[model samples]
Target: MKTIAINQYGSAEEFKEIEMAKPQPKSDEVLVEIHAFSINPMDIAGRAGMLGSPFTDNWSFPLVLGWDFSGVVVEVGSDVEGYAKGDKVFGSASSSHSSDNGTYGEYIAVDNTELTHIPDGLTFDQAAALPIAGVTAYYGMKHNLDLQAGQKIFVAGGAGGVGLFAVQIAKAFGAYVATTSSENHRQLLEDLGVDEVIDYHKVSAVDVLHDFDAVFDTVGDVDTGLKVLKSDGKLATIATQPTEEQKHDQQKQVAFQFTYGTGADLDALAELVLNGKLKLMVETMPFSAENVIKAHQTIEGHHTTGKIVIHVKD
Candidate 1:
């Protein structure tokens, strides 16, 4: 099998392609012939030796680089009950902090418990983009903040992967949504149902907005998000914890540290997709072992409109 992996943890240049043995599923796992995998910010961090060293003994060398995947079940393990061969599915292959390697190859072994059937209407490309970012956005808004209808919710980085999904999900759940983005993404954010689009380059979130019920900061900048929260309101962020000064006026501050894809949550996300309540924003390039370096460079550039996916068909 052909796969892309890291021979060393240094820069995007360190990523290499190799011919590797394909994995067989255990009793609780299903073997998926990967159709597509999407890139995340964490992938760049890992390639840059920022997420420790996945190539070290403390971790694992030649580590697979993707966590989210969508594909068909080529073989089903005996213990898996609800799934079988030929089923279309999508989900994350590991936890957020997982050091167990991942799904950046022609195939991956996924636990049936963590996999979700792709929504009936979505394509493999769209499904591939949903698992990691979709699950994060869903759980972040629905569970972490317990956002209610009519409540004001702010989403920082609204035009990015997770932020785009967050904006749609918040609006679907009935919250008035405000988001931040660059000039090019303002119209896109509006299309996703954002009530207000804050151009980060034009005005600061602190100066232009106030009295928010909750703020979801995907940019990892904690201080800026804290400035806009209403007194005693909850604040959610994927990175950067809010400080004491930032939390001083808030009744509650909840930083959504990490969330992994689950069967139920993925199912809910799929339902939303099937019903047209949510959509996937995909930027795709060819998937090949040799192109891994180029893929990492694209993700590191941070200018993608949404998820960046690699199409792999063995």
Candidate 2:
């Protein structure tokens, strides 16, 4: 199978197409023919060699970089159940550090527990866009922040990939939502039921917003989020880690949430999509090394309004 990978981590221009053996399912995995995948900030960070950890320090070159994918199952392991050769499945990979198992390929062998059936109304592109951002937003609001109806919450970077889903999920829970974004995205955020939209360029959220039940920080602006949060409010950040001082503060609750993809969480998100409570905004690109470079460039700008999805098969 043909796959795009980096000979070494550096620039987006380093991407190249190469031929590799098609992967087979492990005892608890399924072999998927990938149809689409989406780019995330982590992909850019990984390409820049900034995500080095003990788990990824020994990775070899020609590393495939991707996380969220939607594809059709072609083979299932003996241990897998409720999935067949023709099932339409989509989910995030459990680990993005694998050199050979990343989703930026024609085929991938993913664990069955991390895969879920794509709901009836979602397209491959939309399903591919949902895994990381959707699951992160869902888990942060539902688990970390414990957001509830009749309360107020503020989301930083409301136009971002994760922020878009956070705002909608808050609204669905009947919470009053306020967010910060550029003027260009104000109308769209309002259409998604945002009660207040602050232009981050002209004014700061700390100046006008206050007394929120929770703060969902998608930008690395935890200080601003803390300033605007009520004394008893909970704050969750996916962008950066909290300082030691901030973590030990007795007054406010702060947490750094790292999302893990699960079939159960994907099912919850699909239910929201089916009920018309969740929507995805995506820009589709053809699968190619050049387009992968272009997509990386667009996401590196840090101002993209929605997810950028690559059509891998059709």
Candidate 3:
């Protein structure tokens, strides 16, 4: 099998293509023939040595580098049930640093629990785009902040992958969403059901908005998000966190400390997609070891309005 990996952890230049033994499944795992995978900011963060997670140092060079995948099952381990050969599955795979599963390859061996069936009408690129960003938005809104309908919620960086999903998910939940994006994405955000669009570069968070039931800082700009929180409201940040001094404030701010992709969460998201309540936009590109650098560059630029996918198959 052909795989794209980072033999060294310095730059996109470090990514290389190589032939590797195809992975097999364990009793609780399924082997998937990957059709497509998406590039995310996290992938760039991991490559840049910036995301200081436990999984960071666990991976050595020549390690696969993606989490979300859409593909068909080729083999199922003996203990795995409710799934079988030729099932169209898609979900976030745990990294190689954790359990030898990552999606930036022709094939991956994943625990059955981490895989979910893609919605019938969605394409491989669309399915590949949902897991990480979709679930992150869902968890942040449904779990962390406990947002309610008619409440005002702010989403920072609302035009990016996670941000775009956050906007739609917040709307589906009946919250009045305010998102920050460039002027170019204002109409896009409006179509996604955002009540207001604040250009972060032009309008500061505190200047344009105040008093919200929840604040979802998908881009991790904590200082701006905290300014608009109502007294009892909570703020969820993926980037910069609240300091001890800020946490002691009366607004009762909360930050999202990142969560692993879960089967239950994916099912919830899939339900939304299957029911025609959720819409995801995907930009698919061919996946080859040679083009991995181009993919990384596009993600790093942070300009893509939708998920950027790489099809692993020729």
Candidate 4:
């Protein structure tokens, strides 16, 4: 099997192509032939040694550089009952308890609980973008918010991968959605049912939005959302934790998002895709060592509209 591994940290150029034996599954695991994988901010951060010695910690040198994968099952362990040979599956390969290493290879062995069967309406490219970005969106907007109809919610940075998902789910939950995007993404945001598309490049959120309900901050800097929130409103952010000063107002709640993958959550996300409610935007790249470098460059560039996926099989 072929794999991309990072020998050292720094630039994307550090990714190198290599050969390794195909991995085998344990009694509770399944072996998947990877079709596609996506790059994420955590991949960049982990590769840069910012995630606390990924080079020497739970993940060793020449680590596999991804976790989001969509693939076909080729083998299943004796303990696995939900999947079989030739089943299509996608999700984070890491188990709930184990968070290191990744799925950037021709084959991966993940616990059966860590993967989900892909529905018939989806493609590998779209499924490949769903694990981290989709779950994070679901966690923040669906799990945390006690949303009600006629209430207004602001999804900050609504043009990015997770932000796009935030916009759709907030609407699905019956909230009037407002979001921040540049002029270029105005139509797209509006098409996603946004009531107001704030041109964040021109003006700040505090200048335009005064809220009565909730705020989902994907762009970090939760203080801006705090400014416009009503005294009893709630603020949700996936980026950084709200500071003490920002949380001083007792009437407003500052919530931090810690998203994790589960089979039920991934299946619900697939249902949204099949039901024509959620569409994951992605830029597909051929899976290669060189393209891995280019994908990292795109992620760090900070202007990606959605997920950047590498088509691993075809």
Best by TM-score: 2
Candidates in order have lDDT scores of 0.79, 0.88, 0.81, 0.83
Model 1 scores what on Cα lDDT?
0.79
| Tens-digit lDDT track of model 4 for 1-314 | 88988877788888888777777688998888999999888889877877764333456666776879999999999998989999999988662222223677888888855479899889998999998888888877767776777889888889887889888877877888988889999999898788899898898889888855898898897888888788999888888988887777768988787675588888888899888888678899998999998889888988688899999885
Best candidate according to lDDT:
2
Task: Report lDDT (Cα) of residue 84, candidate 3.
Answer: 91
Alpha-carbon RMSD to native, per candidate: 2.5, 1.5, 2.0, 2.2
lDDT of 1 by residue, 82-180 (tens): 888899889887543223336778888878656888767787888888877888899988888889999998898898878999999999999999988
lDDT of 2 by residue, 52-91 (tens): 6743654677788888899999999999888999999999
Listed per model in order, the count of residue pairs whose N, CA or C atoms clash below 3 Å is 2, 0, 2, 0
TM-score of each: 0.91, 0.96, 0.93, 0.93
Model 3: per-residue Cα lDDT over 276-309, one tens digit each:
6677787778877667788788778765778889
Error of 2 at 236 (Å): 0.5
Runs off by more than 4 Å, candidate 4? 53-56, 95-101
Query: Which has the higher TM-score value, candidate number 1 or candidate number 4?
Result: 4
lDDT of 4: 0.83
Count backbone overlaps in model 2.
Answer: 0
Candidate 1 global TM-score = 0.91
